[model samples]
Target chain A: MNRYGLKEKIELRINHATHHIEVDVRDTLLDALRDQLGLTGTKRGCDMGECGACTVLMDGKPINSCMLLAVDVMGRNIMTIEGLAQDELHPIQQAFVENGAVQCGFCTPGMILTAKAFLDHCSNPTDDDVRQAISGNLCRCTGYRKIVEAILDAASRLRRGKRHV
Target chain B: MKTFEYITPETIDEALELLGEGAQILAGGTDLLGEMKRGLATPKRLINLKGIQGLADIRSIPDGFLTIGSLATLSHLAEHPLVAQHYPLLIEALQRTASPQIRNIATVGGNLCQRPRCWYYRHSAFPCIRKHGEGCFAMGGQDRYHAIFGGHRCFIVHPSDLAPALMALDAEVRIAHADDSRIVPLTDFFVGPRDSLTQENILTRQEILTAIRIPVPPDNAYGTYLKVSERKATDFALASVAVSIAWLDTQVTHARVVLGGVAPVPWRVKQVEEMLIGDELSGKRIERACERAVDDATPLRHNRYKVALVKGLLRKALHAAHRSREKGEK
Candidate 1:
């Protein structure tokens, strides 16, 4: 039903699955992900782009979904917190849980996604590097100490997993 | 945000034809979407520029210039090898910009054309002069983050970190219209409150910024960007300095000192540059340059600290540039 109006039916390839959804041109990618697709894992914090709570992986790069229009990201690969785990918690998620990084659990999704994207490129990173990488994702809780520790822990864990493979 | 029609044009011709009153160009939507959400900007139509090809390329031209398309994301440019090798000062500024998430989505054109971060203008209730209102509320109201120089009727500072860095490098921008395009120096691209009360730049409604071109710096040229903020990460600069200097052994030959977060435009202090040129970057010379940097600064009630901040930043940046020369070559 694309009649060149305010609403258009667009296909979003989310989490290795494609879904056709009718969205308003004004709907942000965050709105479409949470309201339409029922992906509540991507929290809506400060609907503005200030807070990175609505961050997701747009083609494996962490971006604030709240700043993007749904129509603009039609065919891009969108990955939310829901897509991070298969049967068990992903290594990043496991490290977060093990290191007490999830205090209020509000900033965990965005923080993990940002950390995942950072660790993917940098197999070994210093504490300052991790801090600079995830500066966008703000966490009022945990004071970012445990979160930073968890990310470093996850990096080593991922490296061990790769060596085992 | 109100409901608006969105169209992605595939070519610059089609995009320019669609651009007019009541229409806004959507490059990355990092700034426009925020404005739309805050009701600071309301458009009847959005012309998304993502579909346009060849607008996001970063390449070195044959004319000894590095041309970057407008739609190129800030993160991509920051990570580009050419940018790192040629213009490290830009990378320094970009690393301190908004955040990783923002850098991933914010475009160079969008960053340059982004609206002011003044709280009074951002709020719809204020209706300040920049919003086509009667007077500026920050002139008397809370203006700790307001401009300290080149502010007349408006005190909002230009918020782009890239602008000052690019200005320090003697960059130019390409502006396209419906029929043809023209190149303008980056220094002339910005418009202060003395010229226009409602707009920040000289871009017309039908014009679009296509790309930015920066000349290849000389081998002896050294550049550095220093920003002072309340927080270490994810915060705008209170006062920033970008210094580009070329030296002949121990004496400065060419210099550009541009200050940000202190004026309606990227404030270039010719007095400081004049003091620096043909002189060795001695400790006493840096002190004199810092003094000249704040001679004409007209700070408001609450932004007097910015004058000091800019002075300190200029001192630090000049010292860094001086140290770079002592460490052999770039």
Candidate 2:
């Protein structure tokens, strides 16, 4: 059904790499990232904005890629979970691993990315702040106690200027 | 989602020229894209409004009104310092919206223009009246979350949290067309199913909402918004109330009580407002005033809880406003 529209060619910088792709106007950023660009780290849970599994950093702000049109993000910097780690895991990711915050690991990438953005603004957050910050990202496996601890631990590590991945 | 032609216009004039039949305006795309994916809306052309500049600014004129662009995202509005200090009701409502990620992408205009969350209307499988079907399934089907105040033929409840708060604050929306521009009260923006089942709002196909103008409240005005959702987070409200009351020493001088998730539009209860005026908001007076809010409610089969829920929410919201006024006095 999507084969009949006018395909538009747009260029976007995804994960610090530039790619030019032709996409239908109806194609969402989530579909373009996974199908066209082969960046499957961003999971599509509900395909709607109800789930945050498709959360990605659009121009340094976390947004749901599933709800955003790919053409709307043209010339903007797009960062997915694939861009979170360089040579090793980022601090928030390392904390998630150490704190055993991964149950099925489906919500890990989105959770860690959201944590990274939240921590960048607020390095000192209380338990309630952490809970409210990650309220958008749903985790069905863990009861979120450990996930909150992981984010708090990541904030502490970042405050100490610990560059260990 | 159905394939459609997309146009990103750079100016308001260009956008207005491009907007017409068979074209849908795309703001943050949080609501529009979801509706398209669910097959509820099928447009041949999609007009992306993000490219237009000056549509997302939140500016407050000195000692005058606060103008919030319609394209401003919920996250931005929730975090703005001026909004937090001046319009806490909007902040509270925006914070309790869909979720963090959705709020980051959902625009204020899009939130106010979102369609009803009725299961039958949303699902393409069922032919509902809103979609030009023969009958409304919720009229006789399961309508636990339907409206109790303004259910005529369709029983869908308005899904926006900000609309109620805006209406309570007496906000005005700025609409732009190709030939002219006009301002409309936020209260008159939404239309009922009885008025026109095909459209939920008064906005026509050729007009675009540009900004929201909120006049500065009186110095003694205190406002609060309370929502009772099924879940603590990321759920639509079962019943919600936004109350703004002006205090003269201790007596209530003016009040605006608006309810959400309980009607086709932002339900404003003038009887409750009139009852509260010229009287001190004591516990007994608040209880009595809240009871009057549901005097005209006509509940459906399963939504009788909403009548009681609205009363409780109204009472809680008034008490909150009273508390805020006390704090301000101190």
Candidate 3:
């Protein structure tokens, strides 16, 4: 039986960098990434899993970071928004820019990550599939039309092997 | 959130033994963590069950039932081939649930055991009867989302879309305790506020739900789940209905009608089921049966809309099931 108030040491591989961090047992992955590691690119919106701003890739699956405990995700590979751009923009990121899908940009990271996961599973998708894929990421600024178009454009680019990253 | 020790038990026996006093089981943490952030529950120890192996598998038992481990994610269940072909009602309800990200993380057991989303119960300021308070604030306050059936002292509704669907499918749950294990019908799982003001279900502190078993669908069985929520997604249902029927050509042989979002539990209307059985699912017959769906509903002041909403949902579900059965025959 574990005792309360014990700080646990957890290691996470974020953006290909492994870090050993100490956190309270109740600390969420969102808090560890934003507060401890200073990866503030993943925004925290609604924190209660209602909003998708805190989405990140865990083992290639997009999940809400705000709802996951850091200790629970020990030794897992997490890809945050900061990891998306190494030297150049990822294909999804470029599509968001060219299609003018980034307005205020709060929901952009989550939208892109969710689209990335969806596109990985479905190479050729329809308009309805794109809509269903990004239904979790809500954007009040772009009215979602541009975001949908950007994802479709990204899907075509990836299918054509135009952009690998 | 309050400070608590997180224990990831590797075995079910270890997890059950750890869940004694001042301990709560943590599956998805989609609901428990939020409740903790809101100062609702301050458990001293959190028994994280994610480390246990073989608890998340979905398998078909030979000559028995389809067993779904409690830890199976909602998204996985929604997309499983067997669920799509055999249990369309569950798929429909899961697709209409919270957004993709939440479904990816939220587990089936966690969804079934999650607490009510009543504003009074969630807010720390209200201190309603569900929170061991003196009275129910939603009785006279903002009660647009309260229950319309099986509510006496409290007026909160069950917030699970899968529960009503499971009830309609005649599912059962396997509960594990330290001493022994037992199987319970999904219909008898939930407890109302009139029965106990504190606990929502019959799960004791020592017990943990292990898996859910769904019997094979009968011949020519058709099922559908319809939900009417305030929003398209990520919102609790205003009212929902799950209809499952075994049709013999144009006549209904067996039927199960379970209602949600307007009752303390998944409300099973036996009268409606009886009315549907042995009768052809005609438009007038469905309309008349739906009219009686809310005959025992005692809607609160602000939720009288749910009475009409439930009827409409029932009618729509019945029609959808009929259409699905027709499409299957082709």
Scored by lDDT, the top model is 1
What's the lDDT for all of these models?
0.91, 0.88, 0.89
What's the C-alpha lDDT at position A165 in model 1? 100
For candidate 1 chain B, which ten residues in a row score worst on lDDT? B228-237
Model 2, stretches more than 4 Å misplaced?
A: A1-5, A162-165
Question: Residue A41 of candidate 1: its Cα lDDT?
Answer: 96
List clashing residue pairs in candidate 2. Answer: none
Task: Tell me the lDDT of model 2 at A22.
Answer: 90
Q: Report the lDDT tens digits of candidate 3 across residue range B221-296.
A: 9888899987777888999999899988888998999998998888999999999999788889999999989999
Q: What order do you get sorting by lDDT, best first?
A: 1, 3, 2
lDDT of 1 by residue, B78-99 (tens): 9999999999999999998998
All candidates: interface RMSD: 2.9, 5.2, 2.2
| Candidate 3 chain B least-lDDT 10 residues | B321-330
lDDT of 2 at A74: 81
Tens digit per residue, CA lDDT, model 1, A36-102: 9999999999988877999999999999999999988987999999999999999999999999888
Tens digits of per-residue lDDT for model 2 on B212-268?
A: 999988778888889999877889999999989998898899899999999988899
lDDT at residue A123 of model 3 (Cα atoms): 87
